[model samples]
Target: MIGKARGQEGREGAAGVLPAHGMTHYPAAFYHMTHLFYQSGPPLYAGNICTGRSGTAIISLMGETQGRVLLVTSGKELLMEMTPSMSGRGMELVCVPTLKYAADRLAAGDCPTLVVDFGWLPPSERGALLELHKQFPKTQLFTLESVASMAPAVPSPLRRLSWPLPMGFADQVRVIAKPVIILADQVLFSTGAVQNAFQQAGVQAESLEFGAELPDFIRRQSEARAASARTQKPKKGWSLLGGDEEPEQEAAAAIGNLVVAQFTGSAAQAGALDAAVRAVAPEAVCYLVSGVDTQRYAMQSLKEGQPVALPREQAGRIAGIMAESAEGGETRLKQRERERILLLDNFKPALTALSQALIGHGYEVTSSMDGAEALRLTTKGSFHLAVVGTAITMAELSGAELAQKMRERDPDMRIIFMVDQYPLKAALQGVSQVVELGLDDAILKPVEASRLIFSVEKALERRFLLLENARLLKETQEQKNQLELVNGFQKKFFATVAHDVKSPLTAILGYAEVLTGKLKAMPSEGRYAANIQTSAKTLNVLISDLVDLAAMESGKLRVEIGTLNLLAVMNDVYERVKIAATNRKLNMTLEVPPVLPPLAGDDARVGQVVQNLCTNAIQYTKEGGKITIKAELKPDRVEVSVIDTGIGISKEDLPRVWERFFQTKEAMGMRKAGFGLGLKIAREIVQRHGGEMGIESELGVGSRFFFHIPLNGPPPTEGAAGAAPAAAPKPAPPSGLPPAPRPPQQPQPPPQNPHLPPQPPQRK
Candidate 1:
């Protein structure tokens, strides 16, 4: 329960309010459950005091006050050493040996917001995360690593339930580190043919070289562990934060003093890695050597203040001089402040607000009137972030090209496309271009400043962090076979959790129907049957989510990714969602693409998302007047959107929609037919393929659901061999993974509250 107190300083020293909902209380015994480990190298948070070589992570916990912390350490020794300040907070640490163990503990009815140090997750344990989600629905899970490395962006039953624990200025840093994904791969060969191709391109790459060595000093101390039984422990039980024991200061001190890091691959990769390291710490030097005597020279040289050695025989006539890679011609950061933006006609507020926001956030801002000015400054000045005023543009620089140019110049600037509207299909296409052009971020127009700021910072910080952290990768030549094996195991394990959660739901629904029929005969079981059916619906939704995720990963969809018109896609979506619209008595409107461009993607999944959004709009509208689908064509992409004059979503639930099994505040107490998977599956489909999907809502008025996709996309290809095939007949040979479109598992209904008002039902 230790967190920012009322009137306490938050980020930027702003005061934060204390628990308004009355924070959950933890039993005193919970603190007695584990040994303590506190670590201080670079202050985990500022003002705590940091020594040694490490970075900073200002915000510590997830947004909400985490009720309890579950630490995954190897043993008490690690615990005592890592947490030296245990006595100050009177905090209790519970050590679960493995990710699975901690996941199981959380699922087995423990309800503490957990802080999992994923560093201990064995390189082999891929599915532990999915397994954990199945059992613990209420527990909000945060990975020490970013969500992407969770592998496949697979939808768990509790998709909305996860947040990240970032240690530094990482956006996903609240969770996974991208380097972990690179390291998670098993060993590959040094002279792999794949690596030679990269080398030919003048891109540094290597499958393997020599195993990196531990620092000489730490090496000598750990020799005894090698001499003793080398226990290949189960990933489930190796929690370093073991059972409750007294904090050990000596161990904490040792953990603090010694630094453990790894480097792998070949000289070229090492050299590139050196570039990465210097990106953060300009003066630091990097030495790459094999496991033999050469590496010893590098180590001894460090200790004795001598120069690093280069072994000519092994390194193949070494290039003597190597320093940080050049940052090229880019010098000063780009600034845009207080200027007229002429591109956008209808979204003037969005443009003006963005400029004001950038200035407020301490950036000098200027508005580009059109694509020409945007292109001019994109190349001329060193701008940190760009807000494209309109979705459509005409001039020398296309919106996507402008973003690309910024990347080419600095490779660190942030670019956001201010889109007005879009179709689900077209939005997915735009997202790919953002990734391809290496732009930082994008936002749909008419966004809140809070939301806009989030994208801006995320985009700006992500570029630099990716550059700096790329070097921190363990850099092994991970074997393809091993990686596949791990991914497969995860795929199967998630399949199992999804199935297991579904079983009880199926049984309950079955029994409820039986009882409902019997109630017609006895009249007594009707109430119980209703309750059972309600619970069954919720569980069913969870199952669907799992199944949808599995399908996407296995690429079981019928259509391959391709470029298609947003207006055309919108027409298709309207046809599908018409029934839902009719039942709700809502009118539909269209504001469409004029000379629409083709969006690159699978048409079917995008259609499914549109249908889901439309259905949601229909259900929420009060005998609704109108719902509109708008498609706006940008320079290099299209925006597809569903606009509805329906009851708007609460701010609390806006973020929850894209999450698995999440329900709106109004729907929480009803026997809703669908589980919370509609939005969850929609988002997974959008973001899984590297697009962004979100909703903007104002309570009681209306909601605008929109997304952007690129006009260019790689052609789709074959589905994975042996995976479930899509329902459609086999198409011509595919060029890429044929991702599936179905929800993996059915989502469950939200937990109903008795005091809430009854939900109004639309006509069937």
Candidate 2:
């Protein structure tokens, strides 16, 4: 009765069958294995033991392999024979099928060569080679025959590791012994590596380059034999899953949006994949197949017809983005419209600050509960990036699935998938990106304002690069149309110039002939010559306006902006064009309100708008009709209008009245010929001043051409206007000369709106 081993009651079983180079067969009902199993006299273990090796370093970690080992298998048959045959070779024996329960004891300065019977478990529990390494450090592995039926399926994670020792002091060295396992493809990998992925999972994976076959279950899936390609599916219960009746549905397959599938159970690994997807394509939505149910659910989604798929090219997008580095360029390519980013998270505190941080970096931000409203938003497609956390519990599409669906509509839509656990191995089936969601990347739940800002800014820097490059390319193509407009206008300008110059030249010569002969005897003939001179002057003004417009189009209009009194500026304009109105026999009135404010702008440009309106009113006003000039001050702006009871503009001509070289048919015939550049120039000047210019008219009635100029600029400070009218008018420069500044040409008085109560029409 070889009962040498002791339990709590100090009892042992007879041990038997032992191998010289293999396990010393010792069995006890309560057997426990440790390097130095102090029992049956000192310690016992026999076999060639070595230290951790080079490259294959597990051996070096077991500092003393030449120590006794307590060995036990659960089966009592093996223990019976080993007890009598044990003698002094076997130390203490205890039944243990797995190494996890004994990790602490193994680390208790004892030999950690574990002969585990893992055959009882299915491959799914095992995950990968590294799982064991991660769970049980410094423990060498040996296998038992028939372990398949001996161990439980999934190890209970809640079970605490047992540490049974009398007194202890472990060595200073921390053993990170990494084992070497040659993959089926002959690819050798260090079991101790931090990133050996699927190979460590029970997916029967080889090296990345050597993977060809999927597990029997996946291979058996009823999918068409289409070549492997990127794919993604909506989450379970999402609208794509057949108008989901259930409010809460997670994405069946997170791998639906990846280029390859890797079976991994670590939530960290899943997030890592998600991040990888973003890094590669910044806007790619990564899906995870976290489990069998998820995979099946996703496959069913495919059979039912997907709502949408990746709408844009991913690799092409990334490449284009790389080509157009938005961060590197100081100038942004996008039109200055503010962009908004949405962070859909249910974990409020964890992600709110993060969303706000994104906004701080100049992006508009909108948040949702999760992916519930996410798909709806993406369908409308305005946001640039969607950041989803794994902990959110909103119904419909999960954050991950929403991202995937969004990717279909906007290939460049950036997505960040965060998770709560080590996703299931099955979830990685077709994923390309997997990011472990945690605080590792400075990602905080209830994220720190600064940290949240940094992560999103970094992501946006990348996403914006891609988006801006694409947008700029499109804009460049559109700009081509503008160039076409430029060329076409060049031809048109030349034709107008020829006609204008020729008409004036003929009138000048004919009038010169008449004045030299038939009109020489009568002073009245001088009036006829003056008419010819006026026509000549008009043509000259037209040519000059054309020249100025050409310069503006060429981007060379170099007028400097400065502070000038708007009232004074208007008065100067009225003085300059007052004669033009008089010559047309048009009655004109100026309505100036009391006390107006000063304005900051290019004195010349403001004057141009005033002059153009006044000139236009006078030109179109029928003989004996009246024209009025009015200015008014509002809290934020000053408005000026030139009203005429002349040949009013037709609605057909109103829209194009400001278009360059566009002349009203009346102006082309009845009114004196003039270049179409006046209103165009006025519009440009107003736009530059951040003001507005427009007109209202009715043919045969009259026209009101008005413009509004802000009363504040050039630092935008408050100041009183120099409303005093000019004491004595200085001689004005020739046409095209920017109006001279007149002592902060403040408004002479508050001008009225062109539509203001007319101060009773004036009589001619």
TM-score winner = 2
The digit string of per-residue lDDT tens for model 2 on 525-547 reads: 77777677666666667666776
Q: Show the lowest summed lDDT stretch of 10 residues, model 2.
A: 50-59
What are the runs in model 1 whose C-alpha is more than 4 Å off?
1-494, 497-544, 552-559, 563-568, 688-690, 714-764
Error of 1 at 279 (Å): 82
Off by over 4 Å in 2: 1-532, 579-585, 650-653, 666-669, 714-764
Each prediction's whole-model lDDT (CA): 0.46, 0.47
The candidate that wins on lDDT is 2
Instruction: Report the number of clashing residue pairs per model.
Output: 87, 80
TM-scores of the models, in the given order?
0.26, 0.29
User: For candidate 1, lDDT tens digit of each residue in 1-764?
Assistant: 22332222222222211221222322222211221123545322212211111111112222332233455544334344333332233223344445644654565454353444444455335245544544564443333333332331221111111111112222221232112111100111211222222234333332222223322323433443343335333333335556444434333332211111333443334444444543433322232322223322233333332223331122211111110101211121111121212122234455555555554454444544455545565543356566654354555555566556555765555667665446665556556666676655556656677886787667667755774576555343245667888889977976788767777777778988888877876655787787778677656655766777666666652334554444556676777677667776888876653344334566767877777787777777778568987766554445567888777888877766766557776766432566566776786566533355656789878988876664434323346532333354322211223334423333322222232444454354
